[model samples]
Target: MKAKARAHANIALIKYWGKSDENLSLPMNSSLSLTLDAFYTETEVEFTNSINEDVFFLNGVEDKNTLSKISKFLDLFRIARNMNERAIIKTINYVPTAAGLASSASGFAALAAATNKASGLDVNSRELSTFARRGSGSATRSIYGGIVEWQKGINDKTSFAVEIDDASWDIGMVVVIVNREEKKMSSREGMKSTILTSPFYKNWPEDSQKDLKEIKIAIKEKDFEKMGYITERNALKMHATMLGANPPIMYFEPKSILVMQIVHELRDKGIPCFFTMDAGPNVKILCRLSQGEMIKNRLMEDFKEYEIIVTGPGPGVEII
Candidate 1:
């Protein structure tokens, strides 16, 4: 049997900006995301008594640190499968080796989904999502088909991500790769600093809750204007909170603003678009399905030097 599994990377609408428990990878608040077809990763897991330790080949590169990051998740899979400790996990990303795409989303999602099958656990999506959450808070959202929410489990059991919508409607993303070759800060470190030092971290509870309610309503009403604006604002505020931290850390760069302003200009031009960024220089722009082509053209007009990617709703895990 071919043990291959495929998972698509997702961009957060209400991002998981800070973590409460770094060791468990728990987040301070719930987050929602939409899986995108722009980038993805595929992985296969097989038991090999021959191998000494859990091994990982990322895009065919043998990296021990990769295995280390993935190591915490393996015990649960072994317990579920009732198997021995020895296994080899092989993963490949469809995206270029360094695209600044959220590989952890697709990477861990594929691992959880494939490991379940590899272990013969017969677990459902909820269980797999829960398992992935332990590895990374956002990983839970990646298991669902389309728009997904990672509900911050009060403990570990109750909090897990679930599918909220198919997002087959007029929704998509246009990623602006401002500096594909240069990464500013790591997401793990940025989130950690924001949690410990940022004064605004306290305000996140009230502000984010309000933002979440409004965005969900906008999505339900199919109000692209409200949804796009709210998403963009939330992303900006999340980065701003980092600046409030002691020895402040920020994800945005000079180019990030240029890209964001152009996205707003597109909205004014009647091709509604809004941008969101993670810990990298790239910005993922939210736009309607009907406006995807127009937005891409607008981006190309100004940013001939940067990569412009257009993608829409993507399915969750699938066998390849």
Candidate 2:
């Protein structure tokens, strides 16, 4: 059996910071995100008796570092279906690998979709989301398109993503690529450090839940300014908790702060834009579609050396 799938990367408006159950990939708080059309991953899976063990290839090259993790993830599916055959997984990522751009989200989402189809599991989207979560928590939301939310359910059965909006409106994002290098500390390491060492992390779950509720309402009302405000604030709060950690996990580089300042300056000039960051140095600007090019142009004037891409809402994971 063989299958191929594509899944787009997402930027969390309401971030997923900590995990309640690290082994199961259960989140400490619910998160909301917007799937972007610009960056994505495509994966192909083929099960064969010829292969003695699971094999993984990324970007046309054998990836030994990630093969163990991929094999463990595939085991979940094999156990579910009682299949003994190993599979070959080939994946290509359009997004940067580990620059806080949610590559893992799209990567694992595509793998989950392709594996589900190739193995003939034929599980629904909710069930598929749980499988993706075992690979990465954010991958759970990548199972849905446009605006999505991941509920921090107590268990695997209860935790999954639900679409909040189709995002067919004028909402979009401008991504500022400050650094494409793989991060020194991964999302998992950062989350564990923040949750265990940060004194400020105790309030993160409750605060993020409140922001999620408000942003959902803002999205429903089509209030762009309100949505931007909550998105920016929620991201800042997450970083603040990281800063409060014992070692102070700082993801911002010199240019990262510069990009944030530029966004704030543009907002002061009557442009309705807000900036948010993930676990790395890149910054994403939330804005209306009509103003995306204008904002991109303005940022270009200041950051001639950086790559800036504008993208709109993207689709959910699908067999391709």
TM-score of every model? 0.94, 0.98
Model 1 bad stretches (over 4 Å): 97-99
Most TM-score-accurate candidate: 2
Question: Residue-wise lDDT of candidate 2 within 1-320, one digit each (tens)?
Answer: 89999999999999999999989999999999999999999999999999898889999999989999999999998999999889999999998445778999999999999999999998999889999999999999999999999998989898999999999889999999999888888989999999999999999999999999999999999998999999999999999999999899999899999989999999999999999999999999999978999999998998898889999999999999
- Name the best candidate (by lDDT): 2
lDDT of 1: 0.81
Q: lDDT of model 2 at residue 177? A: 92
lDDT of candidate 1 at residue 59, scale 0 to 100: 83
Deviation in Å, model 1, residue 183 alpha carbon: 2.9
lDDT of 1 by residue, 1-41 (tens): 12678988889988788777776666788888999886888
Candidate 2 clashes between residue pairs 3 or more apart in a chain or in different chains:
none
Candidate 1 residue pairs in backbone clash: 153-159
Return the TM-score for candidate 2, rounded to 2 decimals: 0.98
